[model samples]
Target: MKTYFRLLSFAKPIEKFAIPYVILTLLAVVFNTLQLALLAPLLTTLFASGSANATILTKPAGWADVTGYLNYFSQQISFTYGPFGALKFVCGVIVIAVILGNVFRYFAQRIMEDFRIHTLLNLRKSVFNNVMDQHVGYFSNQRKGDIIAKIASDVGAVQFSVTGTLQVVFKEPLQLTAYVFMLFSISFKLTIFALLVIPISAFVISKIVKRLKEQATMAQHMFGLMISYLDEALSGIKIIKSFNATEAIKDKFDSENVRYSDLGRKMARRQQLSGPVSESLSVAMVTTIVLYGGSLILNHQSDLTGPEFVTYIALFSRIMQPAKALTNSFSGIHTGLAAGERVLELIDQKPEITDAPDAVSITSFNHSIRLENLSFSYPGRTVLKDINLTIPKGKTIALVGPSGGGKSTLMDLIPRFTEVESGRVTIDGTDVRKLKMESLWSLIGVVNQESMLFNDTIFNNIAFGLPDATQEQVEHAARIANAHDFILQTEHGYQSNIGDRGMKLSGGQKQRICIARAVLKNPPIMMLDEATSALDTESEKLVQEALNNLMKNRTSLVIAHRLSTIQSADMIVVLEDGQINEQGTHLELLQRNGLYKRLIDMQTFND
Candidate 1:
């Protein structure tokens, strides 16, 4: 119940829809019941064809006297205008009741439909916004497919289930109350006997649904795993095919698929079973009422006339309509609330890296980014320890070392992508943690090992965050990255659509585009993480030149897998095993004949 209410909070200001819906629904129910209640008058008045002594009388004063008044007026109408007149009067009343009843019902549905759509909109937006705000480390700890599933499939299920429960909770009970009231007004004793149907349906449904929430949680989780598998297969289609793991991938996915399907089948059986069980109980209740009410009328022991007994049976039988709806929607509501728990769990997660309350926004970069007594770790592993370094303005600092030496980890600390365990990183003497993330990141440009591009036009990709960038500015940035010529050669020039992750471009071309994106941003600090590592010799030269152009007159932190790319760097920092082993000019380092010399010598021999 708590989970369900939390989900409903997304549908704020719900009274806008609720108040109008209640008013119309009440009218619909009243007239609809009248449709059944009028059956008695229709039969008793029109069917008595030869009652020539019928006379007119006063109308019914209140609900308690409606049964007697109806009978009295039926005889009165028969005598006043003839049997034909009473037939016309009763038939006309039933027709008008049907029209007015449906009119109110239609408007009520319109209001409820708006509420459903509005609730879905708010819930989906909240889920997606929270997902986007998570820290970079959060993605590594979770599956991409599961995140996608929560935002897409789970939110969709919530829309149907949670909002549907709203209608059932509000409208159904009022409808049931109206039905019960009319049944009792007809015969208090028989209504009491028929009330057994309520508890029977409630108990049976309770037992059937006892474990539905647990099963639903399992199903949602399994579905996420299946989607994760699908995402992996699609993203790594090239690798899967190259390794000849087609059959292997198929088996892995199909195994989960079969499991999800089987669980779905089981859930369906339980969900499908509720309807029949409740309906059968309703039928049994009606049968009991008939046998019991019939005996009373037959033995002259009850006040209900033949026509009144028929009306009572009609009203009592359909009492199950709302009860059946309440039971059946429970199956869906249970599934939705389970999905809601998962979604809320994600939204409630607080990012470990956040600026202090007094954080100020830095509009420009000046001086150097300094690491003072900095140290960091992961679970059970130290990545960087006692690291102190400085990246001065307008100077290129290259990081070169053997793999697993913490070069990338050091780079991540500059922008506070990962928090430090000890010491501080200060930008111009103000701690980075005390600066708003947007302000710090705005001054830093990053081009990673993998070229990340959206499926969009080259112009848009280059000007991604700078949405208002002019065409001339984007082309100038592209030219600086040596990409203007290649971009124009494409089918649509700057406006040409680059397929997913720039798959339409070669490795060199893609790197140049990434550089162009950085150049357009024109940040004062640049971090190039092996930006040329994945390219061939020819492509590497093109991308290396683009990197040189992007780093001009900027503070640069370069991590290169290929040692030759950083020989001209102003200072070379050699990291080994989470600590800085050496720092010097490339020539000075080679003269030291230390780790830097050995690394350069080995790379020189390979070249």
Candidate 2:
């Protein structure tokens, strides 16, 4: 119930839809019950067969005796205008009642449909926005497919279930109550005996669907895993094909697919069973009522006339429909609640990294960025230890290291992408944590080896976040990164689509596009992580020249495995085994003949 209400809160100002729906539904129920209530009077008039001397009924005292009022008024019409006239009158009333009932029902459904859509819009938007606000590190520890499922599939299930059940909760019980009241008016004894089906259906259906919630939870989880497998396979299709592991990937995905299918079958079987059980109970109650009510009529022990008795049976049978709906909705609620739990779990997650209460937005970078006593760990392994480094403004500092040497981790700290474990990173003199993330990020630019580009036009990709960038500005940035010539050579020039992740471009072209994006941002600080290591000599030379243009008079941190790339850096910091192995100007480090020299020598020998 707690989870259910939390999901519902997304449908705020619910009264805007609820109050009107309630009024319309009430009117619909009243007229719908009238359509059936008039049955007894219509049947009574038909049996009279135009007899002017038909027995006149006493005027009913109050509305509570609804059948009495109907019978009295209908017989009065027969006496005044003959049976044919009453037939016309009763039939006309029934038609009007049906039309009004149907009209109210249609409008009521419209309101509920609007409510459902409103809730869905708010719920999905909230889920997506919250997911986007999470820190970058949060994604590293979670599966992309699992998050996708929660936002897409689970949220979809939650909206239908929560809103559908709410509809049933308000409308079904009131409908059932109206049916019961009419039955009692026709014959009190028969109504009591017939009402037993409600409890019976509830008890039997409860037992059948007792495990539905648990199965539904497992099914949602399995579906997420299957989606995860599918995502991994699609993203790594190249690797799978290269290694001849296509069949292996297919088998892994299929295994989870089969489990999800089997569980779905089980859940469907259980859900389908509830309907039949409730229907059978309804039939049994009707049969029992006929036997009991017939005995009362034949023995002359009841006030139910022949038409009234027939109407009593009609009303009793329909009562079960709402009861059946209630049971089916209960089954659906189990599944909905299961999905709701997962979605709420996501919404409830607080981002691990957030700005402090006194955080200020710093719009400029000056002096230097300093890391003091900075140590970090991931679970059981340490990634960086006591890493102290200072990067002064307008100076290019390069970090040269082997793999897993904390180069990337140290770079991430400047932007506060990852929280420090033991120490702090300060910009100028203020702690990075004291600065708003957006303000800090606005002053730094990053280009990684992967060259992350979206599937959009080159102009849009270059101006990704800067939506208002002009064409001239983009061209200038592209020229500086050596991307303008090739961009214009494409079929559409600057407007050409880059395909997925810029796959339409070559290695050098893609890197140049990424560099152009950094150049457009034109931040005071630049962080390039192995920007040229993946390129050929010709492409590397072009990218290196662009990098030099990008880093001119800017505070820069460059991480490179190619010794030739960072030799001209103002200072070179060597990191190994999560510690700074050495630090000096590139030429000074070469004079020491230490780790930096050994790396340079090894690269030269390989060349």
Candidate 3:
């Protein structure tokens, strides 16, 4: 219930929809019940079954005497307007009742539809926004596809379940109560017999759907797992084929598919079974009412006339429809609540990385960024321990290290992508934590090993997050990164759509385009994570030139795999097993014959 209410809160200003929906639905319910209630009086008035020559009746004195007033008015209409005139009037009334009932129902449906869309918009936006704000470590521990499933499919299910439940919750009960009132007005004894079904039906239906919430929760998780499998299969298709593991991958996905399908089948069985089981119980109760009421009529023990008895049976049978609907709604709410819990889990998540309450935004980069008494860890294992370093303004410093040496982790700390576990990373003199993340990230340009390009045009990709960047500015940056000539030679040049992650471009082409993007941002501080290490010799030379252009006179920290690339770096820090092993100018490290020298010697030997 708490999770449901939290998800519901996303539907803000709900009263706007609530107020009008209540009015329309209530009116709809009234007309619907009135339409059915008129059936009895209309029969008595038109057929003249018992009261063909009955006395010309007067209006009843009170509203509480519904049947008395109905009979009186029917007789009055019959005597004054003739039987045929009364017949026409009853027919016209039934038609009007139905039309008005349908009209109000339509308007209510329209409002609920709008309400559904509005809730979907707000809920999806909140979930996606919270996801985008999480720390880098969060994604590392989560499956991208699971997150996508929660945001897309889970939220979609929750929307329908919630809105449908809201529609049913308000509308169904009023309808049931209205029917019950009419039945009691006609025959209080019969109404009591019919009312007993409420609890019995509720108990039986409760047993059927008792485990629905748990099943629904499992169904949602299975869906997420299947989606994750699908995503991995699609993203790693090339690897699967190259490794000759296509069958293995297919079987893996097929297994999850089977599990999800089986679970869905089971859930569907339970859900579909509820409606029938409830309906059967309702029919059984209706049968019992008929037998008992017929005995009373035969024994001449009741005042219910033939027409009124028929009307009572009609109203009693109709009661089951709403009762059945309410039980079905309970089933739907279970599915919705299950999905809602997953969505709330996401919404309830607080970002581990966020700016301070009084954090200031930096405008310019002037001095150095220092890491003081720095240490970083991830649950039971330390990545960087007691590391202290300074990157001076306008100097190119390279970090050369073996795998798992925390090079990327160190770079991430600068942009506040991950929180500082124990140390202070200060820009100029202000702690990075004491500055707004937007301002901190704005001053740094990053180019990673993987070219993170969106599925958009070249110009748009280059100008991403800088919506106001002009073509002239983009082309200039491309030129500086040595990407302009190749770009213009393409199908649409800067206007050309780069396929997903720039798949249309060659390795060197993609790398240069990435460099162009960094150049376009043109931040004062740059973090280059072996941006040139993945390319062939020809692409390497081209990308290296672009990287040089991007790094010129900028405060740069680089992680280099190839020893030659950082031979000219102002300082090269060597890290081994989460500690700084060496730091100095490139030549000084070579002269020392230490870890840096050993790395350079090994790379040279491999070359």
What TM-score would every model get versus the actual structure? 0.97, 0.98, 0.97
- Regarding TM-score, does 1 or 3 come out ahead? 3
Expressed as tens digits, the lDDT of each residue in 2-22 for candidate 3 is 777777787878898999999
lDDT of 1 by residue, 460-542 (tens): 99999799999999999999999999999999999999999899999899999999999999999999999999999998988
Query: Considering lDDT, where higher is better, how would the candidates rank from best to worst?
Result: 2, 1, 3
* Regions of candidate 3 where Cα sits further than 4 Å from its true position: 49-58
TM-score of 3: 0.97
- The ten-residue window of minimal lDDT in model 1 covers 50-59
Candidate 1 stretches greater than 4 Å from native: 51-62, 69-80
Assess each prediction's global lDDT (C-alpha) against the native: 0.89, 0.91, 0.88
Candidate 2 CA-lDDT value = 0.91
Model 2, residue 354: distance off in Å is: 0.7
